[model samples]
Target: MGYFKDILKYEKKYRRFTVLNIVFNILYAFFNVLSVLAFIPVLNILFGAEKRVIDKPEYNNISDLGNYLEGSFNYFISQKIISEGEIKALSLICIISLSLFFFKNFFRYLASYVITFLRTGIVKDLRDNLYHKIVELPISYFSEKRKGDIIARMTSDVQEVEVSILTSIETLVREPLTVIISIGIMLFMSVKLTLFVFILLPVSGFIISSISKKLKAKSIKAQKETGTFLSFIEETLTGLRIIKGFNAENVIEKKFNNSTLSFKQLMTSVFHRQTLASPMSEFLGSATIITILWFGGTEVLNNTSTLEAGKFMGYIVLFYTVLNPIKLITTTFYNIQKGEASAERIMSVLNTKNEIKDLPNANAKEGFNDKIEFKNISFKYKKEYVLKDFSLTINKGETVALVGQSGSGKSTLANLITRFYDVNKGEVLIDGQNIKSITKKSLRGLMGIVSQDSILFNDTVENNIKLGSQNASHDAIKEASEIANAAEFIEDLPEKYLTNIGDSGNTLSGGQKQRLSIARAVLKNPPIMILDEATSALDTESEQLVQVALEKMMQNRTSLVIAHRLSTIQKANLIVVMKKGEIVEQGKHEELLAKKGEYFKLVTMQSLS
Candidate 1:
């Protein structure tokens, strides 16, 4: 119920709907009881249960309460004197009974109608909140999570929470009220019989509850399995080309099938456990009914009760109504049990602590000044360090290149400088202030990055380049493209800047996309730039074009370049060579070449014919 309470809190926004629903439901319950009593007066008129008194009728005990009610109704009939010959009292009682039935149904419909807004409203609000949480969560959280699993929670899991749980609002209120009203009437019929119900209810509740004890734990596993399989499907679709290339379709399919088989088993278990609720509760209610019949029949036979045969039959029927509600109440418990899994999954995301929120009193840096300093910084994704005791300083308007092997933590350095991830052990200062003390927005705004992959979008070329600088003019965009050497091919395209690049710029060649990425950075023209082997993936002619664009971009900025090819950093004012995580060499490109150390070894390997 703690999970259910979390879901309920969303209804606070629609509290007016809640109040209105309550009002109509109360009216419905009152009329339902009144409707059942209406039948009593009609029965009294027909069966002559109404006492024809020597003097005016007077009140009796509550069981005699129904008797007094019938007598008073009879007096009203006799006083009216509007006799239509076919038993005026019976016709009058019939009219009231029919009217009570009409209003009983009317109020019931109104209650349901009012709750429609509340249920859908809560569903909408819950989904919106979850979406916001997903967007706000840091990218690191997604590293170990499946994309498909997240999608499933957003779509299928949320929908299940809505249909299975939100739709229970009617049952959540009306069923309990129905039982309360029915039990009240039954008590007035005989408190002695009602006491038997009290005993019967608890035992049945205990039995039904025991069946659902482990239901929540199983349900949580089922939902997790759903996420796992969805992740598998998502991974399969994403890498379908590679899978087909390697002829590993059967391998993936078998794994997918295994995941699906497990999901099926879990769901079957959940259903069977849930299905036990109604039957077990129903059987228990039936036993209670049989017990009442035995005890009540004996009283009537011994002349110790005044309940007539028809009224007794009607009371038994009303008690049968209580059976369904008891069953439904038990079913809701199981449903809540199942919903616990969804609630836990959804809450996990919603309740995640944001690791990258701005500090209070954080001030925005006005612009880049002094030097960008990496002072004895270190970091790790897990336990051991990936970049240990790494340090470098790019003086304002200088070009610095980082040359290293594949896993030598070049990319990790880029991530740290960009503050995509924070360093663990030391400070990354900019213009003599700690990067952590500055607002992230202002710090990131001062820099531009062009990664190895040359990330693009399935949008117009203009939109992609003008991303951060949304209001950049066409002329400015054209100049940036020209400077990046992308203008020639861009203009050759049918729509030029307006042309769609397709997904991740897949429509264009590698070098063309890289040039456009450089163009985007040029347009931003931030004081600082980081190029992660940007031109390495290009063909010979395209590589030359992009290398020229890079020289132009780094002309007067504090630039940090990571190069795999060694030759690209020949003109760098300072060349820093790294092995693993530590910088093994540093100085002017000529000075590093003269060292004949790791830097020279890399150059010799790459410079050969």
Candidate 2:
């Protein structure tokens, strides 16, 4: 129920629809009681229990109103029966009951109809907000989170909420009102029997509640297992080639099967407990009815009750009517318990504060100027610093190359400049202004990053090239593609630029994908370009072509080049050699080579390889 309080905010958002649902549900409950009570007059007509009255009943206070109405109705029916016969009287009663039943169902339909908007609207908004949060959160936030777990939150957990909570909105409103109205009618018909019924109900509620107490814990376990298996699925699809190559499919399959089996076992227990609500409530309700039947029958037989034979029969039916609603409410409570588990998971994400949000007075940087400088910055993904007290300055329009082994912090410089992760100490600056003070959108806007993986979407070549620069004309895309050496192969495809590259551009060769990535950066034409080993994964000929395009794109731009192959940085304005997160040496290509230091050793190693 506390989790329900968190979800009430969404209800407020769709308040108009929620209010309509409540209003119509109240009508439905009122008619639900009337439809059952309509049977009392029918029973009176059938049993010939009418009492004669010469005049109409007078207006009176509500205390004796029930008896007065009963007497008045019997008197009217007696006159009708005396004139019209039993068949006509029975026919009139049947028609009134039928109308009451019809209106009851009609209002029920209206309540359901109005609530559909609120239910689906909340689900839609949940998805929208989830996606926005996923996209807006910093890259570092995802490093420790499983991709499948996040996907599970968006898919399975949301579906659970829809089934358990959102769908219960109608039952939450309608069923209790139905129970309340039914009890009111029963009390008017006979208060002592209703009071006996009230005594038995709390005991039944306690039993149902006891059964549902452990449901939330089980549901949470089930949801987590679902995420675990889904992670296995995502991982299998992503690394299918490697798995098959290593003949490790059986190992992965076993892990996934075990995960699903655990999920299946947990859900079996959860659903069994959930299903108990119906029969358990039904049994308890039937027991209460039997108790009422004994007591009310004794009172009637002894003439100690105000309820007559006909009204007592109607009272029994109305009390039985109350059972179904009470049963429904019990089931709804169990469902909400299950929903509470999912609600907690969903809110954990929605309520998460982004650690990398812009400051209150953050300024939007227009474009790059002066220089990009790392002022004694220290950053760490976890405990150990990846870059420590590292400092460098790349002036505008200068191409600076950082050369190092895999873990020597070459690529980390690009990450820091782009603010993918912030420094634990010191500052990153552009034109003497701290990057933390600049709006992230504008700070990244001045840069173009092309990494070694050649990340591309499942889109056409022209569209992929136009990704960051969506409004660019076709001519601009073509000109950029030609500069990146991608236009030649793109035009050779059957559909030319319109050809759909399959997922992540898998249909293209490695070199072609790399060229498309380069074309994308070329199209953006940002002043600051970060080429993170753009040609590192290619063969001799492909690397030659991609390297040529990289040089073309880097022309007249302030560029940070992270290179493993020393040949690529031979002509850089400044080449910095790094060792264990510290700059070992930095100078022009010939100057560093002449010193026979770390840079010279790197050149010698690459030349031999």
RMSD list, candidates in order = 3.2, 1.6
Per-candidate clash tally: 1, 0
lDDT of 2 at 177: 92
lDDT scores in order = 0.83, 0.89
Residue 134 C-alpha lDDT in model 2: 91
Q: Of the candidates shown, which would achieve the greatest lDDT relative to the real structure?
A: 2
lDDT of 2 by residue, 120-226 (tens): 99999888988999999888878878888899999999999999999988998999999888888788878888888888889989988988889999999998888
What global local distance difference test value does model 1 have? 0.83
Error of 2 at 72 (Å): 4.1
Task: Give TM-scores for every candidate, taking all chains together and pairing residue i with residue i.
Answer: 0.90, 0.97
Winning model by TM-score:
2
Task: Encode model 1's per-residue lDDT on 23-128: one tens digit a residue.
Answer: 8877887787777666754465456565433345898576587668757766665443334433776677778788888988998898889899988888788788
How far off is residue 357 in model 2, in Å?
A: 0.9
Q: What is the alpha-carbon lDDT of model 2 when measured against the actual structure? A: 0.89
